[model samples]
Target: MREEENIIVGISIGDLNGIGSEVVLKMFEDPRMLEFCTPVIFASIKTMSFVKNHFKLETQLHSINALDQIAPNKLNVLNCWKENVSIQFGKEDLKIGEYAIKSLSEATAALKDKTIDVLVTAPINKHNIQSDTFKFPGHTDYLNQELEGNSLMFMVTDTLRVGLLTDHVPVKDVASHITEELITSKIETVYQSLIQDFKISKPKIAVLGINPHTGDNGVIGSEDDTVMRPALQKIKESGKLVFGPYAADSFFGSNNYKSFDAVIASYHDQGLIPFKTLSFGQGVNYTAGLNRVRTSPDHGTAYEIAGKGVADLGSFEEAVFTAITIFKNRTEYNTLTKNSLAVSKRKRFNPKN
Candidate 1:
């Protein structure tokens, strides 16, 4: 494991025409952030320089061509591409989308090779980012393939944490996608993530029902009782502290989510709508159950506020902080587990040696 100060965080600059660059630069404006982890922006210095000038930010940037050239205590911008990119705030340009993919793919590769300890991606436009190379719905889908593990979309804040059973799937297709296997896999992923990423010992989890009032006892829908309930029952029998298939409507309004370590919503809006509302738009979207740690601000490109220099950076900063903390937690967890296994083997082989 790398030293705490030396933990390199790779940043993917998403959607040049949007506010991705603005929030990223704004978050690193404070010199104190450099003390937490080194940031390496996988984008060109020229483009970042233009954005910095437009935003009139005082944060200085260091340019590098390779990962080895990264300097600590400074905002390092890796030149992923050198060609000049025309910037127009609040406009959707397909050309800019390609650059977003470039930055993301490079950062992801670095993560896989251990060149970067963790990754904090800026928000990208889902519609414009489509191409022959990148065909996934969002970051979670792309990273699910690039990295290892089950890959659950886990939205987190200090007090409340929510994971989606099905992410980026349409409402019509959500139920068909939710099977016993998927329910079991996603729940297990959230449980293990709470332990490995957040350092929770006995994680309590609650699952939101697919239909309203958990299908009103099969009146509204039978999938909840037939599929979700049976899956949760099977998991509970294995001794995990998992519960629910609870009513989504009143859960957050009544503050019932406060009881559990994490909540699993049946679909995207079911989870994110309440999460964004309850969290006050300050949550971090963490890609959990993966071999590497990756997080992004819960908000989107915010094109309306692009280049206006009033973009709220609380979520972006929190994403960076969360990524660093999770990386450390996962590192410590893995080390301890390996040591315990080694000790057990030694005891078995030679009890008194």
Candidate 2:
């Protein structure tokens, strides 16, 4: 068995009304989850108890006030929210939104403090959670605000990875959001994330144009030729392996995406359409450029199947595994870089006999 000290995974219980609790309960029932890391859930003990009893799952829950109290072979619960209210399964309630946000905030804080290695977040409802206190669209936006620099949402499968230049924005506003600076920054972030987190050194990134046939060379729209092309040129000059302004229509038809490490699309649909067509229920949604690792199942809350006990756990499983893999890879890469630099320094200072 792997030592518990090496792996510590923090989990955020998403909306108490959604399938988040059910999935978390089901996941912890798997004895193998302890083999990879000590799982710590940031939620109230009462909330988790309701879930375990409602689902009739055979999992043990240990309540702890702080992350340092996490123990191996036991499902640790870091009670961040008080169980002052009632939770109705499969029902949307504004009251639970605050609790959901609290769990996420506490989990993120722990991650920032390095108390946890990776974060596996459950699904959250954007409509219920958006309020005066928590105005962000979703976890991606919240994470962006919590970390320095920009962050992009990337959906990943075993064979394909797609990054969104603009997410959770209306189609009318997508063009306005796709400015030269935003496009360039998002692409750079995606490239860097693929290399650093996914371990794809010298990553090849493809940029998808905003219009059909790449704006037909300025006939359909000048955004592709004037804005996107200019950004691509600048990126290319920086010696980064970036290509395109390729027409969004034909880019995925020829299966050209396989040649690159990731694809950056101009809007949410432009990237997600092809990604969902290929990845469907098996993809993992990862928020890149945050100080801590965060990943969630690509699919939504699945309200219809919330308590049916039939919701596919594949995506949830994949999300947790992806977080673990990235955490380990990042650790190894940092060690290698430090060792290489030390060796170079020693070689430069050594005197010849």
Candidate 3:
């Protein structure tokens, strides 16, 4: 795609004391990334400067004072703050968390206003970035509240896609949260996203059971038999190509996940443990079923490797590219459906008739 046709990607600077700035800089370092999309980082220029200098990296910076002045080839850093915030690197600071929130809030506003086509959020320390203002588990939860929609944390890679039925919830609390309604709704959302977001015409899905061996037909646990199996039957009756309350342990191990387009894991660790183990740096977390496009890296803010310049940009860059691809695919799908009835009629109408 040409530079002008490239989608506008708005990035939120996560905890500055973490690897957010480092990874963001590394993504744009290649210069070729600009040809695919126009990136505008919602961060203080000072933060970018500090990270750049500390790593001794070379890249041109274009401070975004005005939206219309965005340069296609330059790294656009919209100054969310005027003064330079202190870089603590490995330490968590209140000032850093507050600053991260500012960037997120502004970027979110821009997203809602259509200032950017898509958003690529950096990883934030959930505990530090929390307050009365930000009372959510993480980015996915925060955006779901902001956008007022049922959001599925869809983890993606080239070969596999996994969506969480319940994310960021503890193992003890997970059973209580897994209800018939929740499972049905999330599966429907995943189905729609498979068709609309991923452009799969007929997507097959696998639903992992809450318990081992899928309750072993009611011996291991009852939720799988009482809740998930019934819900899966109802979903299938509704004409969706969904199957399983399969045992989580054997689903991936038996290579059953490859037969379906997507897998719905019961909780966080159940899904992410295997996904990260297999895809790791190549994975992208996409928020499905929202009105706007949003994606993030599969990994979190690595405090250990914060300013060491060893932070890999694999997931972050993939997140940006994935956002752009989804945005473009959505636009194309919308355009295709605009006159679908007439198009169908014309294709079906024959000269003999």
Q: Please give the ranking of all candidate structures by TM-score, highest first, separated by commas.
A: 1, 3, 2
For model 2, residues 46-115, the per-residue Cα lDDT tens digits are: 8798888888999889999877788887889998866555877678888888788889999988887778
- Top candidate on lDDT is 1
lDDT of 3 by residue, 135-173 (tens): 888999889988857999999987899999999998999
Q: Provide the TM-score for each candidate, comma-separated.
A: 0.99, 0.94, 0.94
lDDT at position 216, candidate 2? 91
204-275, model 1: which lDDT tens digit per residue? Answer: 999999998999988999999999999999999999998988999999999999999999999999999999
Candidate 3: residue 239 lDDT (0-100): 90
Model 1, stretches more than 4 Å misplaced?
A: none
**Cα misplacement distance, residue 258 of candidate 1 (Å):** 0.5
In TM-score terms, candidate 2 sits at 0.94
lDDT to native, each model: 0.94, 0.85, 0.87
Could you tell me the TM-score of candidate 1?
A: 0.99
Off by over 4 Å in 3: 1-4, 341-353
Candidates 1 and 2, the one with greater lDDT: 1
